[model samples]
Target chain A: MEYMIKNKNEQLTNWVNEYSDKLYSWAFYKTSKKEVAEDLVQETFLSAFKSFDNFKFESQPQTWLFKILNNKIIDYYRLLARNIEQVTDDEFLSKKTTDALFNNSGQWVSAPINSQWEEQEHLLDNVDFTTVLTNCIKKLPQNWRIAIESKYQEEKKATDICKELDITSSNYWQMIHRAKLQLKICIEKNWIIK
Target chain B: MRFFKLSCKKATEMVEKEKINGLSFIDKLRLKLHLSVCKACRGYEKQSTLIDDFFLKTSASDIDNIKIEENPKLKETIINRLDNES
Candidate 1:
């Protein structure tokens, strides 16, 4: 019994050292915020440590770690939902001036465009990108922040985020819309025109 | 109306992902109106279109070889946090 315990401890430590960086990178990509993703990675490892004894080796240790990380991400999001009060529309949008009516039918691409839209030149311009978005995210209500992070940073689909948050389809879209509006204002305030 | 017409962020996001279509009629019109008058939106539209084109043309691996900065004390930091969990 003593031998089994010692051996498992050694193996888990090795496992931690080997996979931590890759897993941290994955988490970083999903969460965007370095500190938050690092915190989650630590939580993932702690959970793995506790459950090490029960691991039956049905899957590789990496796969097992993945399962744990997925649950931790979901829980982190759920806990935030509970703590933050629901966001109201006006608090979300600066104001609804009646300048442009929404036209939902806009095609994603308008005739292939000039194709310069995706140029790496613009993406890597090191332009004051953050100057544009600095306070935009802060203005969002907590719930909307989670939705946006999951949507873009995590690359989770709207469907999956809605399912995880237990929000209806309409509510999900509305929160996304409000988040985008705030972001737009921030972008407009900071963009450098050539 | 001013915000909607002037803001091209939506168009930029969609164009980045090569994801278009599924917008409603009114949304399309609003976007068009925004694009017609707004220089910033026009620039964004141009930039996004180019980014997509580059990705489509580049056959190389999407993976970037970013140098990893080890938090030398990261493990210790995490271990200390775990100890406090009790």
Candidate 2:
């Protein structure tokens, strides 16, 4: 029994060496933070090592590892969502600047300020535009960021995202709407004007 | 006109809802009418779709191309944690 455990440990170590970079890259890509990504990768390996006996070995270790990592990412976002729910309110969705987009009668206050965006083809292909857009996304409130990331990065169903985040479906859509509004305004300010 | 008319705010919400959850028939019609007259909301729709497509396309393939610099110590750290666990 002891010998079996040791053998499993060695196998896990080999996997750690072989797949850590790939896993780390993926986690970083998902989270956009190095420390969080590293911690998640470490947790994934630890969890995998603990469950070594349960791994059927029919699937590649890489697949199993990624499945664990994906769950960790989801849990991380879920936690962020919960924390935001407790700490904040719907004010994030109804910022004064966003309110300024419309008049009291709910009519647009100005002409389309983003007409400049329409002129630019393949905006993401421009490295500077991509950089500015990335910064704009980062500037969103944490919950809004999670909302956008869960929708886009994870490609999750709206209902599933609401369940995972413990938010109502209405709240989920509202956050996505507000996040997109903020992103559009940010891009216009940072990229279009500059 | 008020019955068929949708506020720009409500129209924009419907626009977002169209992407998230398809709107009801009346709601769709109302938003369509609003956008027909509201150039600003039309701009909002175009920009919103652009941002959505940007994320959708990038999330599909951008990560594979991004090279996140590897941490040489990450392996050592995981191995040490495993050792501590056992």
Candidate 3:
């Protein structure tokens, strides 16, 4: 048993030497942050080492390492998404901007702005529009941002996000709804008019 | 009239909810009824769906093309940590 553990450690050490750079490059590419990418790569290797026993070697070691790194990236975002300290329940419930969408009788207070988005082809291909969209996403409240991120980036189910964030399903959908409304307003303000 | 009437606020909420969890028969019918008369909610639905598609496309396309130089010390740091763990 001691000899086997030593062999495993040696194998992992060799992998660390060979693949760490590639893993770091991929992590940096995904996150676009230096410290976060380095931390994620470190965590990925640590996790890979801890679970070395389960690695069947059916796949290339590099493949296995990249897979582990991908999961670590997901977990990093999940952690960020869960950091909702700046967003409070009251703020979630009473966002004045979204509230301003409707009137006392629950009708639209003003006509929903006619979006020219449909007229534009391949809007995402336009770097300026993407930059604007990215900024708008950043401007969302943390919880709302998580809701959008989990839905789009992680492709997670609504129930799973609610379960992860410990929010009710109603709250989850509401966050998404308000997020879209705000994004629409922001995009219209920044992209269309500008 | 009251039974078929759904508030624009409620109609928009149902529209978003439908994307995640499909609405029930009554809620769906009410939303349909409200939307038939309300052009603004219809516009909201279209714009909201467009935003969702943009998010989906952005996530799919954005990250893979990034290029970066790898950190030299990462391997050393990882090796040191592994040594401590064992």
Candidate 4:
């Protein structure tokens, strides 16, 4: 038992030495601040080390690290906006999104801007996507982040996220409203080719 | 062009609730009009989505500049600590 602990400690340190920089960069994508990202990455490693004994190797270690990092990012946001006033009150299920990005009216309640796409739109050429995305997400209002993460990551229904956040169905829609606009503004400001 | 000529804020709400019924008929007509001419809006929509897609792609392998500090002394320090603990 003692020998196993010693070996595990050595392995854990090895993992950090090899993975810290990469983990740090990934964290930067979420926080958009170097210091905050580094702190989260280091904390991720520390947490992993503390719980090394329970790691059953069912999945890759990176997967494990990411789950921890995701939780940490959410926690950071929760702290950043603790004083915010929420308007929604539903407990579970979202007000919409049962259909898809496009709704049934086919009229699009929130019409997506349709434009002619160029050939280069699909290119993912080892670009610094992380930096670009992190900068954009950071500019998002706290409500936008809350809405996107709940819908996209947590897979919670809109109603439920609204309930948990104390926002209304209307407020929930409004938050998404503002978020998409900001995202469009951010993209125009940062990504479009001249 | 998409229907739902929602305002930036209203558009975002529409997108969030994933709703389609609340938009005015004129709103839909205008969105279609805009999409027909704007290349940039198309790009903007793609970018809006990348925020979510990026999260899924950014596993540990997506990290950059990860290299172990190759100092022999660090290895020796570990060995010493191991020796002492035993």
lDDT of 1 by residue, A99-182 (tens): 122234432224223322223355434446543444556565556676555443234544555566664544555555545545
Worst 10 residues of 2 chain A by lDDT: A85-94
Please provide TM-scores, in order, for all candidate models, with all chains considered together: 0.52, 0.84, 0.80, 0.49
- Name the runs in model 4 displaced over 4 angstroms: A81-170, A182-194, B1-12, B19-86
TM-score of chain A of 3: 0.71
Give one digit per residue, the lDDT tens place, for model 3 in A1-194: 98987888899899988888778887776666889999998998899889998899787898898888877777776676556446676456538878887888888776435455545677667889879888988788766776676676466655565566554567668778888888877777787633
- Which of 1 and 2 is the better model by TM-score? 2
The candidates, ranked best first by DockQ, are: 2, 3, 4, 1
True contacts kept of 1: 0.07
What interface RMSD do all candidates show, one decimal each? 7.5, 2.2, 2.9, 8.2
Q: List runs of model 3 lying over 4 Å from the truth.
A: A1-7, A17-38, A73-94, A112-116, A155-166, B62-64
Q: Which is the better candidate, 1 or 2, if ranked by DockQ? A: 2
lDDT of 4 by residue, A1-194 (tens): 98887787777667666655556666665566777876676667667766877777887787787778777876665554344345333211222331233445433334333322223454344365346556776656555565655444344443554555553456556555555555544444565442
Shift in Å, residue B28, candidate 4: 14
Q: Mind sharing the TM-score for model 2?
A: 0.84
Candidate 1 structure, TM-score to reference: 0.52
Candidate closest to the true structure, highest DockQ: 2
lDDT of 2 by residue, A68-119 (tens): 9988988888777666554355444546667787799988777555545745
The Cα local distance difference test for each model comes to 0.54, 0.80, 0.77, 0.53
**Deviating ranges (above 4 Å) for candidate 1:** A18-39, A53-67, A82-84, A87-142, A152-156, B1-74, B77-86
Error of 1 at A49 (Å): 2.6
Docking class of 1: incorrect
Give candidate 4's TM-score. Answer: 0.49
